[model samples]
Target: MKDPKRADFRGPLVDRRALLVAGLAPLAFPGPARAEPSPAPFPFGVACGDPTSDGFVIWTRLALDPLAADGLGGLSAPTTVRWEIAADEAFRHIVLTGEATALSDNAHAVKIEVQGLAAGRPWWYRFMALGHRSAVGRAATAPDAGAATESLKLVAASCSHWETGYFSAYRHMAASDADLTLLLGDYIYEYSYVGERAAGRPRRHDRAADVVDLAGYRNRYGLYKTDPDLQALHAARPCVVTWDDHEVENDYGGLLSQDVAEDPGFPARRQAAYQAFFEHMPIRRASLSDPWRLYRRLAWGDLARIHVLDGRQYRSPAACATATSRRGSVVGDDCLERLQPERSMLGLTQEDWLYQGLGGPSARWTIIAQDLLAASIRQKGRNGVVGHWTDGWDGYPATRDRLLSAIRNSPAQNPVLLGGDIHSFWTTDLKADFADPESATVATEFVTGSITADPPPYAPFAEMLPENPHVKYFESRAHGFMSIAMTPDRMLTDYRAISDRRDPRATVSTLRTFAVESGRAGAVAA
Candidate 1:
């Protein structure tokens, strides 16, 4: 249903201005004639991530003298990419410079992992290629070993549906002072439907309809990157990203497509999606694969260890047939009966790897950066029958239970699960026995809300939360990200909400603050 040959931009491409009342140029215009906007050296903007105390990765895409939308941009020959890191925004004290080649094979994107730097310091970076300059970006390194960090702040967010609304939440996040961003998943959706019913409104960009091939997926990512808010967010902070079901196809696993019988070439389609995903993301080369690598760990000295997991690639199929199932009925007796211990979300190899990482971690906090809700949530549906999203951790009950038990029994200190994907926000106390209301808490989970995606109305979910005892807080309406501050004694999370999505300059507000003490696994209102 999507036209691959079409240009990236749709509709009229022109900037309009309102005339000034005082017989002068509009307020949008400058006071006098100035130099033309320079062709950016790094047209795709700048990004920094995968930070360690010694060094961090700096990234930029070269697009000097870019050509028009025939998919031809810049020179076909490999270009020499150069970058510099400065102690100030003005580049007065340039400290590091490096040269890397941007090849045609990877769309001229340059990712340089600069090492040998001062730990726990802020740095500004920029790129140079083909006689143009990139927009300056800011990045920070982690604290050194045995350093007693007073606090560390990070923003966690996910589930951005571009067609539903603007990415105003990202704009707010870009302006914030968070050191890093943990993007949980649903970076892009892969379905096409006619009329307003598909997105519940008329679509903006049409190329995203049922992305199958590499180009289709690339174009979809390009469309999302074009959003100023999203670009600004990427340019500002170091982001640790992972994918959810929507990145490839909703509720898909391995070779299984959404409608397996209807689409037999799902394996090939998945490969294409994975390739495109690797190309656009700021992930390291080691993570690239024909299928894709899903698990990795990032360390921040003795303070924290972030364990990133891939939930969709090697996961089991959804347990229910209904479009929307409540907690109890979602994973019916038959489905629950079929959940074997061997049925894995992170395959055997990844499981072993995760356990090894967990065992070696002695940080103040072991944060699991994952895609779905780790806690069990049950709610009564309209038919007065209880249901659940069998697609989440609830589907693989045994595996979830094992993982919880591992955390409880492991040497890892203060395990906290950070997730996104349901679009709604939730805070829960993870326990070994969720069936028992007063069960001992083993861990804590904070499920951040979506960036722009519309969560289900608040009224229904609000009424349902009271019945679920483990759930500490739940909100279904707002669209924003979570700001988490971690310390030796406690971890504080602020649920920041955007005032509105329709407006570009929407202000962000802290909706709630919750904290989990060092020894306590449950979160208390801050």
Candidate 2:
């Protein structure tokens, strides 16, 4: 029997007796850090992300009016912003301080990369500008590259639509004892309205139409950032983020738009969206030089190595895409075009880099974080034909095979894949050959559900489960996040479910728990 008191990540992995374990500390800031002033200079709050052993990037935008019509955060002239990092919540034990200029060119956002700090320790930070002080944010650096550590705790979430519901998942994450947070993708949606009942939405979007230019994209991000729960989540834990299709357009691939006729204008629009994303996110400043580059790796001592991937920027047009129809479609499994070896998902350069890293010196655990599901979900299509979704890995069979082969042949140990953008929870065994149900399982996969977005109809998806033996579990009727705790011996994953998205103070419970023992390539119910 499972111990109910120690079910959640906070209760078991983080001990209440001794809150601070080595460099990992619980979410405990001073009282002032929890409150944000209305219509204040830093209304959007503060964030820190992209952590390294030395230091991490800290961010804050001077937005007295975040929803301004011009998308400038209501700042006309450049302002100098000061930042400080301290060992304690108060500024008495200051370790580092610096000044940065927030200008209209970058939407009045100040992002600083602080170096020379102690590795693997917690730091408290805050900003000052426009005669007002921002909320104090808590951040932590990574453990040294190859150092041995006891365990790592992580929280993962994605697919947040502002008009659909509230962000209670982010609120709960802010109060947890997680060392790092992973935002897989779909951080913001382009459309002002999605699906039916647009007029009766729980919340209204900031724009009246779909976003097209830099101004529109910046405003969309501003609208999402202004949410109190999202702000609190950023202020609580450091996040590592990447983008999916909704950041540009629905189901778009590379330079192609949803419809082929709009391909002519897709380039300019994509460039604008990329620029806006960089300006608002807590990513490194070095990424601005080559905005298209996002795939990177981070090491968590000898316990784990996280390989973050970019799946949208360099993918080929969806297989069998037509000029008059959709960008991605459900095609029969017999479709020959999707099986072509030339159809690349991560493009050539990214594929080479990933293959090289997968074969490098081994870590105790290898975690691959990307934007979409890597497992096959074949189902019955119209006219009694088996089909696959062309927008995901099912469309590029050759690419998936090569990736699985590399993992099977590499020295990496206990590989596990993490994904989002499906708006549903899933646990599957990644087999060397998905076509053969009895084939060897090479790795395990866990795809998180949406934070607030609507899920696809559950009945239809549930009916197709028997055909997929590799899929261990599936659930589509909830809104929440995943809590993962990894040790050298085993990995424990909890599928946390929120009771209600419409409620501001919704309660979260563990809907299910699964465990994968060391050297095991499949998840078993715990």
Candidate 3:
């Protein structure tokens, strides 16, 4: 890429090192096809994520037809690709260059974790393969640890179920000037649409069988990757990601399936989903062989620290699940299992790690970037119902209390949480005890709605807010991402919502704005 003529080449450019992995293609899946291949294989586009102070990951997939039926992405052979990271969009100052193998075993995807560069700066990257070059993408590195950080602008998004709506939210996000994006899971849904929902489906899976196996999961991911808005979001910013239940099976816990506790195939299916997610995403060294990992931390100098927590893989099973009827969603007095003290969401080890991270007065902004929420939301009728939601932190009250106590006991300055998964915007004051209105407000939780998934009903959730005083704001009817702009003094959160999900030319506007002042725990209107 040093040559001016080669640098001027637009479209896809396969790296020279791709050939090294190319010769060994036969050892991978799909074997080596003698048949002629397509000229351009970047069907799924390019992405970058999991950034650090020194480096970040770049990703691309070789797919002739992203929605191909067999979920092979029309790849009959392994392919080679080259990647480069530049200081500018014009590729003037090339920093890192490398080759990666797009193996069929990984669904023809390539992920190269590039390192050893300056921190807190913007970078551009692209992929080349088969004489064609993929589109250019932008990513940013975290600032050096213990260094002075003035401000950070981040975009938070989640719960993008493909069939429900269009991804205009992602399009808007991709066009934004945010430094990074955080995808709070539900990246892909595992259920098939039926009845009227199927009739009005915006998109359909390649093969809609609820994704039980490897092929099914791969096809599902391929189907979602075909969206231009989603692709643009991936290309526009480096992201910190963690998974929730929808990526595997709906409402699934660590050691148990959503319903039946002893489904032997659940682990294999989950492993396939995990592998497929790792293949598609630009995450670095994500564990597919383990069940209890993916919880880690990323720092942005002394200004901010992001704790990406995985609440799905280590949590105890939902309360009140039984054979023949395993509905563990609703809260009620009948479910004694929900109040078990041993129930955990982040498991014991991860919980302790999180506590330690929040124990000290370190970064000016200690942001908890997790998938599930911690607010105590209840449903209400004329009697004002108070149900214990076992799916989120409300289900594991003991652990939630422990975390809140840690934040309160710690000398940390500004403790804030950016969360997604409920598919509705929320600005709640996180307290140690939901029952005690006078309990100290330990920290703040700002939850964003879905990118394209269906908007949740507003009225019922609205009724419950009166009883739950800790909730400062709530909106259940919207589809968009949240933008968080944080400085050392205060963090401002804007709930950016799109006008319509189906419209290709939808406009984005802020639904509300909330701010948590530095040295303060609760959030107030900005």
Candidate 4:
């Protein structure tokens, strides 16, 4: 067993690039296997994620055919896979390497968490399985606790529905020079592609219906991973992921599914989707054991702290879920059930955990990387009366209050919410009371738009923003992601969009920019 107290495993080693650059002896890799492995085995490519001060997780699945009917990736038996982490882009200076099993039960997937490395430095890694070599990927260890830095860059994105359009947005995100990528949710849509061409849909599923069982969910994930653009992003940077609905089913909340009534078999389906999520993601084993409790915190030295929340897993049913109406797409005082204090979006355990993180002082920037909007976004208002769509934090009024109150009373600095799932960009101030126009700002929020998925109709939102003063910036025509830069005193966000999500050759451009200065409550033009 490794001693838990070991600092690092550095040793006298040659850098991978040094051999070519310095004209030194070439470092030998593992000798050839009995049979040369083909690139087909690593079809989904390699990914790195969940980075920490000492280490991060590297992931890849051995797949002969990614879209196999069984979603098994064509591996029927256990296979041995080799992994290595190097200090530089070249593998000459190897730090950690070992053998791991890619088991059939685990979808022939391999996730190796490499540790005992130098902190706050970039590292490169690759995989070898079945005699084939995987592509190189980059990841980094977080700065040591209390470590200070002038700037840290991370990209925020979400909602990539395959059939909506080409993933040109993701292609652009892969080129960005950032430290980490955050895939907020809707990593893969559960529904199959079978709509009218007249509807303006861009693509269709290869061979699948709506995902239900483990095989279905696994296949869906595999199909989405097959996209070259999506694969490139996963390979470029370590992604931090959290799922919203659609990963399982539309509007699913714990045991209850959206657009449908709770069924006796919903729990079984949830378990299946939960397992597939683990098999594909670079998440640690602890997260896989309980999908309902994925809320966790990560710190980037003293620069920033990230708290990612699983909003759909344990949230109470939508506020206006009625026998006939089923879902509350839009409503007003008629949805009185929304006023209950016990109606929670984060549930009890996650709520307490988040409150504790907010109440502490550890980082200069306190960020909540969540799966849905938290502001009081409402529509259909007239004569000082307004209504809300009961899917977001607006439905859980009391829940929102508790969270905002915690921020108000906490020692947390520059609390900002980074959110997705709305399919539009929104910059809003989290207020203590939405009804009271003079309410104090407790936090700031920046909501990113869907990468390629269709956004909501713009006219209604355009009409609604005038009634909602807290919403500082709103745009629905964009199909792209947010690039954010953080410092001790300010955060700069770029709302990027592509001209044509339908065109594979589309170019990405910034639509607008906003800056949140430390001690200021809302974003301002930068």
What are the lDDT scores of the predictions, listed in order?
A: 0.74, 0.84, 0.79, 0.81
Q: Write one digit per residue (lDDT tens) for candidate 3, span 237-304.
A: 89888888888987788857776853678889888888788888877664556533688788888898
- Write model 1 residue lDDT over 359-476, tens digit each, in one string: 9847888999999888987765566656555667777777787788788779999999999988888999998898898888999999999987768777877777766889999988
The lDDT ranking, best first, is: 2, 4, 3, 1
lDDT of 2 by residue, 206-288 (tens): 97799999889999999899899999999997899888999999988888888878889999999989988888888874455
lDDT of model 4, residue 37? 37
Model 1: worst 10 consecutive residues (lDDT sum): 18-27
Runs of candidate 2 exceeding 4 Å displacement: 1-39, 194-196, 285-289, 381-385
TM-score of 1: 0.86
Assess the local accuracy of residue 488 in candidate 2 as a C-alpha lDDT between 0 and 100.
94
Query: Model 4 — TM-score against the truth?
Result: 0.91
Error of 1 at 490 (Å): 1.7
lDDT of 4 by residue, 87-180 (tens): 6676655666667788889799888776666678788888887777887788888887778777888888999988878888888889999888
Q: Which ten residues in a row have the lowest lDDT in candidate 4?
A: 18-27
Worst 10 residues of 3 by lDDT: 24-33
Q: Record all residue pairs in model 2 with backbone atoms less than 3 Å apart, i.e. clashing.
A: none
What RMSD does model 3 have? 6.0
Return the lDDT, model 2, position 329. 66
The residue pairs found clashing in candidate 1 are 326-387, 326-388, 327-387, 327-388
